[model samples]
Target: MNTGKVTLLSAGPGDLDLLTIRAAKALAAADVVLLDDLANPGIVSLAPRARVIRVGKRGGCKSTPQAFIQRLMQRYASKGLHVVRVKGGDALLFGRAGEELAALRRAAIPVEIVNGISSGFAAAASLGVSLTHREHCQGVTFITAHLQDHGEPDWAALAATGTTLAIYMGMSRIESICAGLMTTLPASTAAAVVQWAGTADERRLVTTLGRLADEANAAGLGSPAVILVGNAIGEAEAFTVRGFGRAASEGLAHAA
Candidate 1:
């Protein structure tokens, strides 16, 4: 029996519309889909013929083990099934695609990758700001706050880069992240947080580094959010302090 292939599909940032054409096609032909916690559950509509498996991986919450997910993919593909491992945001950006790719290769299963919009870009879009503006930032850097070894990245070095910093999975350590970067960057440096970017339930907080933690906490922004810090953030349309609690609309404060 011939072994099947695996397609690591990017579901984009919780928005079904952000899903790429190629990704939709892959889903339409899927045999088994391993969905992530962040991906829109509505995406399963495209894969009507496939068996949808909720292999949710969420930070700071109960999640399906990476090894187990890999084993499931290997098992399904070994039986000649077209396995689609759906991930939120760009699959290559901190979605553990490397491990899945390596595992599939070891098992001799052909793999295909379909890219989609990352949350960093979506966050910037939500704020109507360019992460790498020629006048503001020389470039942009995408980094994860959480590391496999549980070590934090060099915040001072990153701050010195003079580029827009789009930090992922850092909401839980917003205070620490702000403190580390404040060591190099100014306390008044522009900072923003976009939660559930590109989705209807999206919320945003725009403030300075010194007040990011406090403002974000007061607004009740939580995990699965993108933390953006840098001078480029000052270029955002509404660079002034803003909050998004359970109910918030235009003009900063939470709605009464």
Candidate 2:
């Protein structure tokens, strides 16, 4: 008997509109779905016939263990039931997808990955700014603030050299990230926090490297945010004519 396969789908943050048709179909056809908190539960509602399980891992909060989630995915797929692992944002970006992929590969379970709109790009889009402005910057690099030990990101490379930095899952360590970026980035560099990008509640706080930490913290931005640092983000003010980044200038945008 052939066991069912597992689809590792990127749910693209909290917005259901960002989901791809392939992912939507997988969810609808799934017999079992493992969902993370970042994903809108309404997306799972499409797969009403499937058993839904929550295995979310929120920062500083008690939640399901990673190992347990991996085991459950394997177990359910082994039973010949289509398993869908719905994660918020692009699963490959800071989502620990490599670990899960390895476990499934070792277990001989077929695994397919579906990419979604990443929070970094979405945040940039929401701000109506270009992360890779040819005049200000030519390269856009994505990096996590830390692994687990709170060690610094690859500051020496991206910062020392020239590249736009789009940090993911860095809200919890905005202070640390700010300090590190200051080491190489100019103090006057433009920076911003796009909280809950791609949603109606999207909020954007544009400031400089010298005050990004204070501004983002004071605004009380929460997790699931993306921080864009570099001169490329400087264009946010001009982009707001299209209603993009209106939150910063209009005051209607609260810290989401």
The 0-to-1 C-alpha lDDT of every candidate, in the order given, reads 0.87, 0.84
- Candidate 1 lDDT over 95-199, as tens digits, reads 899999999899899999999999999988777779997888799999999999999999999999999999999998999999999999998888888888888
* Root-mean-square deviation (CA) per prediction: 3.2, 2.0
TM-score per candidate, chains pooled = 0.93, 0.93
Query: Highest TM-score among the candidates is held by which one?
Result: 2
Count of backbone collisions in candidate 1: 0
Clashes of 2: 1
- Model 2 / residue 35 / CA error / Å: 0.3
Residue pairs with backbone atoms closer than 3 Å in model 2 (clashes): 13-89
lDDT computed for candidate 1: 0.87
Instruction: Say which candidate scores most in lDDT.
Output: 1
